[model samples]
Target: MTKPLKASGFLGLATMMVVGLYQFTLLAGGNAVPGWMIGGHAHLGVISILAIVMGFAVPVIGVTGRLRTAVTGMFIAGQWGIPGVVWIGEGAELPFLMPTAFLWGICLIVSMLIMLYATLTQDSSGIGGEATGVTPADD
Candidate 1:
């Protein structure tokens, strides 16, 4: 897995944690939590983890060259884009944010589908060394 993807994942988790702390502080201060913040917090965690997993998955699925680059970029974009637009849109009370969020979500789904297709069409017909009972050390 690449460092960038893992770093992004960790960064997302850190952001989520910070948001959670802010939410707690808000509650403590007798302020109501905003719905947009809640949504952003959730997405930060989810997308971050997905980015990390996809980092490991990309090479396993044989996604190389330009396609790999595209998919990785897409996932990285989605890791930050979804939550960012949501927070900005909802925080600023913009109506267009929801559609933008949907678009980001769709981007994530498309990235996953690309990796899935690669996995499905592989010659081994299985993922990782375990599927074939062959360990990396054997290779």
Candidate 2:
């Protein structure tokens, strides 16, 4: 497990806890949520899952060092902030969240492109060390 994966797992757990807290509050006779509050639910569930999925995917792509760091930071922020912006903008009514979210998304895209380029251009496959002219199992 990589540092990023651990972080994402924590975020996923946090997201779940937040959702549970909301439900518990409602069950306890807390005020009913406004329709706009639904964004929080989507963020907590979808965004968190996306981050967790990317966490596992990172290893398969063989990200490491500074590149890993960049990918982790961008992906984590982007995944969470994608929904976070909606919460901040629509839920909290903050106008600035959109720009912040946009920046995070851009960073995430760059990191993804970098990961794709590196993974494609470089043969991180261990097979190169062993035998040549042999294709991958799935291939």
Candidate 2, superposed: residue stretches over 4 Å from native: 20-32, 127-139
lDDT of 1: 0.84
Candidate 2, residues 6-71, lDDT tens digits: the string is: 577577668767876886687689677655456556655765676677677666677677888877
Please give the lDDT score at residue 133 for candidate 2. Answer: 75
Q: Give candidate 1 misplaced runs (Cα > 4 Å).
A: 130-139
Judging by TM-score against the true structure, name the best candidate: 1
Give lDDT tens digits, candidate 1, residues 1-139.
Answer: 3567888998999999999999999999999999999999998999899888887888777887777877888888888989999898888888677678777777788888888878778877545744555566854
| Candidate 2 global TM-score | 0.67
lDDT (Cα atoms) of all candidates against the true structure: 0.84, 0.69
